[model samples]
Target: MTGSITIALDAMGGDDGPRTVIGGAAIALHRRPDMRFVMFGEEAAVRPLLDAHPEVDKASTFHHCDITVRMDDKPSQALRRGRRHSSMWKAIEAVKTGEADVCVSAGNTGALMAMAKVCLHTLADIDRPAIAAIWPTMRGESVVLDVGATIGADSKLLVDFAVMGGAMVRALYGIERPTVGLLNIGVEEVKGLEEVRAAGRMMREHDMKSIDYRGFVEGDDVGRGTVDVVVTEGFSGNIALKMAEGTARQIGEYLRSAMRRTWMSRLGYLLARSAFEHLREKMDPSNSNGGIFLGLNGIVIKSHGGTDADGFASAVELGYDMVRSSLLQKIVNDLNRFHTSDVPAVPAEQ
Candidate 1:
């Protein structure tokens, strides 16, 4: 870990405003004593919360910003209205100016992404940025990219996601040459969209050392942990993410209902209380709360808007890990190598 890592917080961005952000920062500080914070929000709303958490208050330098982006604000509207003054914009600016290593926000996702792109800009050769989420798979955890960052992707963009996701896997999981798979409807070479097929051929031919390109994977393969990184355009990626989350919740509800249906089942639940507790912990969304915005010049983490303090803390820790692992440098190195390598041209789309 670095001797000291500073995180910028959009202190008034989330559903609970300063309460959730401050509490999460306090929790993060507890786990990482070397962490410091630069908080931006309304002074009146944030100061009282800071008073409640002396550890975070002492470690933090607060800046008052009267404006905040609303959750429903469109991306363009946010950019126009909150550009220089809003808490979200200032938080991102801190990263742009090197005032903080990373920025964490549980704010309007659209607004946050917009401000981040405008403030820090995309890295060289990256056409668009992506959001990579740490997914809880049966085998452990996998990195899934383009989870609602943008709506569509071409072959080149898909390749970019693969490289970026591979870098993130290495940073977060210490997996060198992480296996990457393109999420598709089928595993066959000719089974998916032309763009996906083209992307696959490009990856196979280039054979980048940073990632082992597995041909294609179906939706079920994601939870099976068939690959260390799952790459897809944001449209399908976002749908897959939401579906998986809903399924987890649905299954949990079914289990609860089944256990409460009869005295016998309730007794069985009691007999297996420890196992259930472990299962609950494993299924907890809070454990994997942060979605990393990749392919950017700086690190920015977006937490679930409705997540509690613990979940937000998980997001902060994610930023800490990214900085500690030197994620941006790794991505740049991979991109440079991939582009400079002598490789065959991508065949024309059928």
Candidate 2:
């Protein structure tokens, strides 16, 4: 945590391109003076932006890349066309080559995942990588995994997500033995998919030291912070994440509309302005913008493409946290423990 950490940035990946990326690097550099950057993008577009931020310019080393992955490109198409030449690919390469501790990109999620999996590869015993997001909860925050990585998980994959998610909590929050629960329709043993139930049974029977399995958690339990980590397939996890974001936006709009409805409402809003501001800060999606690709041999952070400078900075800071905490090693240790345990084989789908 004390030493200098280098991060690889895909400057051309986001909706706003180098402008947002450079601005974000400046903010992140200001906060963490020990952080350095290796930026990958077209020189003509990115260099001027970098030069404008004197602090970021001094701390960064830029590399020119001719290709930029299109937001609409499919994962297969991205892999075929942008494998080696794209800005996103080069940024991830920096992590693989040890030039940077982690890679951060606000690119197409599918393209980023494709490039990362091909370049960095998954850690041993990891069948598939998962995207883990930090969820704001009633207690504080919780880690949720498979938030749109690959869809459809078997029993074994769910257990793997639990191990990875627990490791992530330990890395970010310093929780020694994080509690984990499967995201399900109900908390009962008999509810939800067979694979989920089997995973629950497996975790209960094995009782892994790295995580405390808390059985099934209903969707509502996620916001309540019933457990430190929530595990689910990408399909459901992605839906839950989108729904939460939409609901937050909806509530904010409702509040704004109500505040302007009448003179009395406007006066009440003025009286409670500070509290409203606090609520806005808590509900802001930008605060929790980074989605970490867990199970990779190297760290890759996916930032929301539409995010602004502050949101992108949050993603860079997340990459810094993962590097500082030795997240990869912690995951390896956890997975090793789980694989060596007396857990039963995953039952086939009914």
Task: At residue 218, give the lDDT of candidate 2.
Answer: 89
TM-score per candidate = 0.98, 0.97
Q: Give the lDDT of residue 302 in candidate 2.
A: 96
- Stretches of candidate 2 off by over 4 Å are 346-350
Q: Give me the displacement of residue 132 in model 2, in angstroms.
A: 0.3
Q: Tens-digit lDDT track for model 2 on 1-350?
A: 56899999999988998988999988888898999999999999998897799889899899999999988899999889998999999999999999999999999999999999999999989999999999999999999999999789998899999999999999999999999999998776667898889888778778689999988998899999999999999999999999999998998999899899999999999999999999999998889889999999899999999999999999999999889999998999999998987776654435
lDDT, candidate 1, equals: 0.93
- The ten-residue window of minimal lDDT in model 1 covers 341-350
What tens-digit string does per-residue lDDT give for candidate 1 at 169-286?
9998899899999999878766888888989989988868789998899999999999999999999999999999999999999999999999999999999999999999999999
